[model samples]
Target chain A: MKLDSAGLEILSGGECLNLLASAPIGRIVFTDRALPAVQPVNFCLLDGNIVIRTAPGSKLAAAARNAVVAFEADDFDATFRTGWSVTAVGHARAVSEPEEIARLSALPLTPWVPGTHDHFIVMAPEQISGRRLSR
Target chain B: MKLDSAGLEILSGGECLNLLASAPIGRIVFTDRALPAVQPVNFCLLDGNIVIRTAPGSKLAAAARNAVVAFEADDFDATFRTGWSVTAVGHARAVSEPEEIARLSALPLTPWVPGTHDHFIVMAPEQISGRRLSR
Candidate 1:
């Protein structure tokens, strides 16, 4: 789909979600040290939840104890002059149950950056919304 | 500065911070119901804190009662072929004190979206970090 400058002005909700589903990575955003923070992670949309893996003492591990967090994924096609984004808001918690962890870990979520993928943080969405710039 | 594909690959820590300082809007990330959530907000890099305005029943109001959250902002320059981003992670709390609220509300944070902008949520960064993809 080729998009002109004008076509990139407004995006529909379905297109936004479709874009999000296709992207395998996104930025996990949260507050740390009284400031805004973001980190890149490999993610998967499983049964309507966002899941990622991290090591102990990592920010993801620490955030699992928090009450809420937000996650976002986006893609921009310069050639096509189009882009889409999706944002999810919900509670983040660590998945410690052996069965659940194993099941989630079995998914295809290989981190682009190499590190210990020990901890798993799941962001369960209470509300999912998005926007797009498309022709 | 003109950023080519290669020049946009590497971004210094200071550059990232400066980009963050210049931008007035960011995405607030949190967990709503075991799911990832994000909302756009007008923010300020005030005294090292990220602040935004919202209504009483808004997501920001509810997140203030939580222990932690994340915030992120980014800018992409297709012309210059460069982009920069910054992320903050820390605890989020509501500014209840009248004086503090008044002081924060005084900042130039006009909502791009129309609605009741009453409640104020502050993301106090325990850790601030960023990266840039430059050419």
Candidate 2:
């Protein structure tokens, strides 16, 4: 279906979650020294939380500890100028329990960057919103 | 050149600016009620600043006033697992002068979302960084 260039459809919560689940990567936005920062990372959705692996002592692992952050993912086509974006905002916490970490590691998430990924950060989303632009 | 997965090449300042100038879309990260929030936007590089158009009094326009924000743009190939990302951190200010707004409107920035985008937000970057990953 060809949508109007001005059409921006607001997605429902279920739609947002479904789109998020279909993608394997997203950018995590967090604050560092009172300034906003963003990093692209591969993530997975499990048990209503967005989970990602990070190296120990990394800025992401350090700043995201029990802090509120935003996660965004989008698929855009520059040629067609059509795409959809989803943003989930919530509190991020480090996965401490070894058993839970093992369980999460078993999930289908692989670190895009090469390194020893020893820590898992889970963002239990309190808000999920998305928009799709088509033409 | 096929780069190893472990090789994440750091981009220099000129490289970052060149990448930023090559893309017309990016995500703007800012604080909303002290929580990090991200929104995908269409922007252009002008006179060493990242300029974007937004609707007046929107959350982005409101929170970004004199605020330190982050702007990010990237292109990744999911199949090949290779991409580059550029991020700029700086202060955002509203462009109130009519002449400046008129001049920016003449630039190549076209907002993807349809609306009356009368307000222009200029991000004067203080720091710019980027990374390129390859297989």
Candidate 3:
């Protein structure tokens, strides 16, 4: 909970989750061909896990299955030079159960990509950390 | 370039670099402690490479030196359910020479965090790809 020299406030775990819940778009980071790859995706918070819908055979769906990943979201005002960023580190698991997938699809977690989003990847936040830069 | 089912247009390499130059913020994904980690950073494009300033002892600075990383930036309209995302994948190198660092510091690549950002990391975009979702 220490503030950095630039007045960056380290947010608690609860605050980190709250900030994450406030954003709908985030970047999911995973290993691709032994190198890091990232892409922006629309997601929702379901039962403390970040849920994202992807199409089968997609790079994200392929790389994220049962893999350690990171999700990051933030809102920064370039003019004001202030913003808060929250990052969630966890392991992503594909939702294979039909009943659970159906239940999750009923939520507001709609994919921005136009197509069948039959695959669901859920990342349970194992480590949540956030920092807010302010005056 | 191929279009997805939902009208997602695959952008060319030149176009991806153009989109990247239009933004000032992006997420840097790197491996930390043998796991993937992501953090939002302020950067600029210089001579076809992504340049960022970081504190000397920051985790990003430590992990990014001579490491393969991914930098992603995007702009999406939730209301319209459309937007474009561009990602740059390359190896990051620390700018150790004082002359280059001084010259780069004169650019608009100011560090958002409050502190001495003497360490400069530059990533030459080896693989650039972008997708634009539109009707």
Candidate 4:
């Protein structure tokens, strides 16, 4: 196991992607009012890309258009102090073309809330990294 | 039950703080290489301020110094599709003074990993908000 400077195990690119795919929920980081902001969303991994559905006019949609963003997902056992976190940095593009929107709509992605989630944001990660902390 | 435009219930400020205090882990969003980055950390709520400990030379410690960042914590039940999320945005200042650091050392805050977490970052949120999704 490769360990980082802090002694936590460093995850390979494949392991990072696999861990990201295994989780249904993740946090998206974007700039809001020129400062960093985070929002939790249900996401899916498609062809090594991250996809999230949101309202077209939602705050995230506004900030994520062609924007550099970070997506993170993890699971931990607080009692055992063990967990792994995966972070993917990429450019978020809003799907506006009818054909692309139709394609994404066919995916299993669904919003966690009850409302219209017609917009699709697809991110192809330029950097994927993860770390695992063991008890 | 106040609902936002997206149909998610908007939680009150007090409720947001309460929920934040209940969570042991949260994702902290900060700028890195001129892009957004997120990492999950175990944190504590003290006097309505968010405090997290990290390595003195860690990436998080460097990026969080006097910078505007966001902290988010949430809990969800995928089976029932019920969840709540709280987001706090403010300036993150690294605590360096000896007396202050000495006082913080007495807190219950502890690092999730097995390493030295001597640097402290505290954020007294200027803006706090939260939302809930019901099944």
Per-candidate TM-score against the hidden true structure: 0.56, 0.93, 0.95, 0.97
**lDDT, candidate 3, B40-91, per-residue tens:** 8888899999998888888899999899999999888888878899988999
Native contact share for candidate 4: 0.84
CA lDDT of every candidate: 0.66, 0.87, 0.88, 0.92
Tens digit of per-residue lDDT, candidate 1, span B1-135: 543322323445566567777875567776655444566566776777788887777655786565577777776553443456676677888878999988987897765444567678887777665656554
Which residue runs of candidate 2 sit more than 4 Å off their true CA positions?
Answer: A1-7, B1-7
lDDT of 2 by residue, B1-135 (tens): 333334578888888899888886799999888778898888888887999898896888999999989999998877788889999999999999999989988988777777788899999999998888878
Q: Which candidate's lDDT is highest?
A: 4
lDDT of 4 by residue, B60-134 (tens): 999999999899999988888899999999999999899999989999998877779999999999999999998
Order of the predicted models by lDDT, top scorer first: 4, 3, 2, 1
lDDT of 2 by residue, A92-122 (tens): 9999998999899898887777888879999
Q: Could you tell me which residue pairs clash in candidate 4?
A: none
lDDT of 4 by residue, A1-135 (tens): 999988889999999998998898999999877978888889988899999999989999999999999999999888998999999999999988999889899999877777789999999999999999886
Query: lDDT at B20 for candidate 3?
Result: 89
> Weakest 10 consecutive residues, lDDT, candidate 1 chain B?
B2-11
lDDT of 1 by residue, A18-73 (tens): 66678766777665554445666668878777888877677557755655666777
- Displacement of the residue A123 alpha carbon in candidate 1, Å: 12
Which candidate number has the best DockQ?
4
Docking class of 1: incorrect
Give the docking tier of candidate 2. Answer: medium
Top-TM-score candidate index? 4
